[model samples]
Target: MVWIIGFLVVALFVYFAMLGWRGFGLIATGEVAGIGLGVGVILLPIIGVWLVYSTLRAGIEHQQLARAIKDDGRELDISHLPIRPSGRLERDAADELFAQVKAEWEADPEDWRNTYRIARAYDYAGDRTRAREMMKRAVGQYHHVQGR
Candidate 1:
């Protein structure tokens, strides 16, 4: 899986480089419209690289936090939760679980562990937007606590 993802990322980078080369070719034309289009095209690769780098960094950080939490035996356990046919947690059970996790987070908002749990709860409850928000918070808190 890692190899596959790495290969895909490399391919994406190559594609972005090609686009950047084309953008430079356009800029070399010295026409106003070509220069404008060239600038826009060049921005695409720059933005793409930044997005990929940031996403991979966050994923690595999240994995590190998960490993630390597991080592400390602080990982959230959802084994008792009811599951639906599609392999997701039943909606009601997920909501109840989220309520419990949210209360824990509220009680000690400074704790990265609690924040991580709440993020997972939000994910399980099918609230992707909130889950991503909480996960980003958890990542920042974890980094701060680790002095990283």
Candidate 2:
């Protein structure tokens, strides 16, 4: 799995580099419209690389936090939650779980563990935006606590 992912990432970087090369070719044409298009094309690869780097970094950080929490026996356990046919937690159950986790988080908002639990609860409750926000917060707190 790691090898496959690495291969895919390399392939994607190659594709982006090709796009950047084409953009420079367009710029070499020395036409006003071509220059405008070339600049836009050039920005695409730059932005793509930045986004990919940031997303991968965040995912790695999240996994590290999860591992730490699990090692400490503090990871959220949702095995008892009712699940719907689609494999998601039942709405009411998810809401209840969220409420519990939110209270924990409120009690110690600065603690990465509480923030991580709230993030998981938000995710299970189908609030993706809030989940992502909380997860980012948790990651930041974890980093700070670790002096990273």
Candidate 3:
């Protein structure tokens, strides 16, 4: 299901990119307006491509982590996790949740699952930088243990 959506998004981006490129070719090359349009035409596609690549990469990484967690046979209790209508956790709730998760992570710094949980807590807290850092750590540990 997600793959279908991803494919549709990529197709849309590609279609728009082709149109932008065609528009660039129709503009007079030497005109200032043409230069601006050309830049926009080039940049928009590049940004779109980057977006697609990053999103796919992140999804793949997350899926791999989920598989690892499942295979580990340990359950993570998220019943008390607070989420808002926007699909994000409330700041105060996230902070409290993060504190508990952080303690567990500190207790076993080498556990990839714990690290991943911490990353998720940070993510819920709207701290993407910390979340990414924790995810990197989690991935590294998983890879190391898996001999990958």
- In terms of TM-score, the best-performing candidate is 2
Instruction: Flag regions of model 2 displaced more than 4 Å.
Output: none
Question: Against the correct fold, how does model 3 do in TM-score?
Answer: 0.71
In the range 1-148, model 2's lDDT, one tens digit per residue, is 8788689789989999999999999999999999999999999999999988998898888899899999999888889988999999999999998989889999999999999999999999999999999999999999899898
lDDT value, candidate 3, whole model:
0.82
TM-scores for all predictions: 0.95, 0.96, 0.71
Q: Model 3 over residues 1-148: C-alpha lDDT tens digits? A: 9889778987878787796776577465868888778777777777777887787777788889978777886545566767788987777888888898889999998999999989888887789999899888898898898899
Counting clashing residue pairs in each candidate, in order, gives 0, 0, 0
Q: Residue-wise lDDT of candidate 1 within 42-114, one digit each (tens)?
A: 9999999999999989889889889988998988889998999999999999999999988999999999999
The RMSD of every model to the true structure, in order and in angstroms, is 1.0, 1.0, 3.4
Cα misplacement distance, residue 40 of candidate 2 (Å): 1.0
Q: Candidate 1, after superposition: displacement of residue 147 in Å?
A: 1.3
Better of 1 and 3 by TM-score: 1
